[model samples]
Target: MNKKEDSPSSLDLIWGVSEIAKMIGRTERQTYHMIQSGNLPMVKQVGERYVASRSKLIAFFIEDAA
Candidate 1:
């Protein structure tokens, strides 16, 4: 087995705004705007991509819900 495969890259743990939006029940447009404007937590632009970590977003929203 490959070491890189065994330990996933940070990029592998994140999802684009569209996917993240679906997971959080928000519209893709709104999610994209929010993330782009830095209104959402745990989202950032890496090179040409906007991405957020699945676990971090889950924790953030859960804490927010509480």
Candidate 2:
């Protein structure tokens, strides 16, 4: 087995719309609007819900800050 395989990855952790909103201090409704407006990237969709990875969201903030 590889050492990498033994460790958990933050990138593998997924977050839903509400979690993300709480992280960024926004309301769920506003988060949804951000997704629809192309401000935030949606990594996956399940029925009516949106999902995003923590790493991707951090990258978004980094890029936006630059």
Candidate 3:
């Protein structure tokens, strides 16, 4: 397998909204609004894209569920 397959799917680093949205099953626009409206924590807009930590996204949901 390649490097990406060898490791986890970058779930612990900062990435743009498009990629982040794919991970969380949300549209890019929805993710943008989520960040803008402060619904999802630890997310922010940087230039034309919103950025967030994938691990934090996972943690937020897990925390919310509990």
Candidate 4:
């Protein structure tokens, strides 16, 4: 099995794109575009899903607000 598969499925420190979008009041497509445009930090791909760091997302909002 690959190392990724060997890793734990439970993520304690990250959020998926949909979850982050809901928190930030943006659509999933918008979030994906942000990632594509480098407006938002890149995400780590897990299987077929993209995951973002919760802390990073919070920081992004804080920076944007500043």
Ten contiguous residues minimizing lDDT sum, candidate 1:
8-17
What would the TM-score be for candidate 1 when compared with the true structure?
0.73
- Name model 1 segments beyond 4 Å from true: 8-12
Per-residue lDDT tens digits for candidate 4, residues 1-66, read 687756655442456778767767899999888777888764676887778766667787898899
Tens digits of per-residue lDDT, candidate 1, 5-45, equal 66755544666677878877899899888786876867877
lDDT of 2 by residue, 1-59 (tens): 78775656644555678887976679999987888888886456777767777777788
| Global Cα RMSD, each model | 2.3, 3.8, 4.0, 4.9
**Each model's TM-score?**
0.73, 0.68, 0.69, 0.66
Best by lDDT: 3
How much lDDT does each candidate structure score?
0.76, 0.75, 0.79, 0.73
Q: What tens digits encode model 3's per-residue C-alpha lDDT throughout 1-66? A: 577745664436666887888978899899888887888878866797667778888889889889
Report lDDT (Cα) of residue 44, candidate 1: 78
Clash counts per candidate, in order, are: 0, 0, 0, 0
- Ten contiguous residues minimizing lDDT sum, candidate 3: 5-14
Candidate 4 residue 37 C-alpha distance from true site, Å: 1.3
Q: Which whole-number lDDT from 0 to 100 does residue 13 have in model 4?
A: 46
lDDT of 2: 0.75
Q: Model 4 off-target regions past 4 Å?
A: 1-12
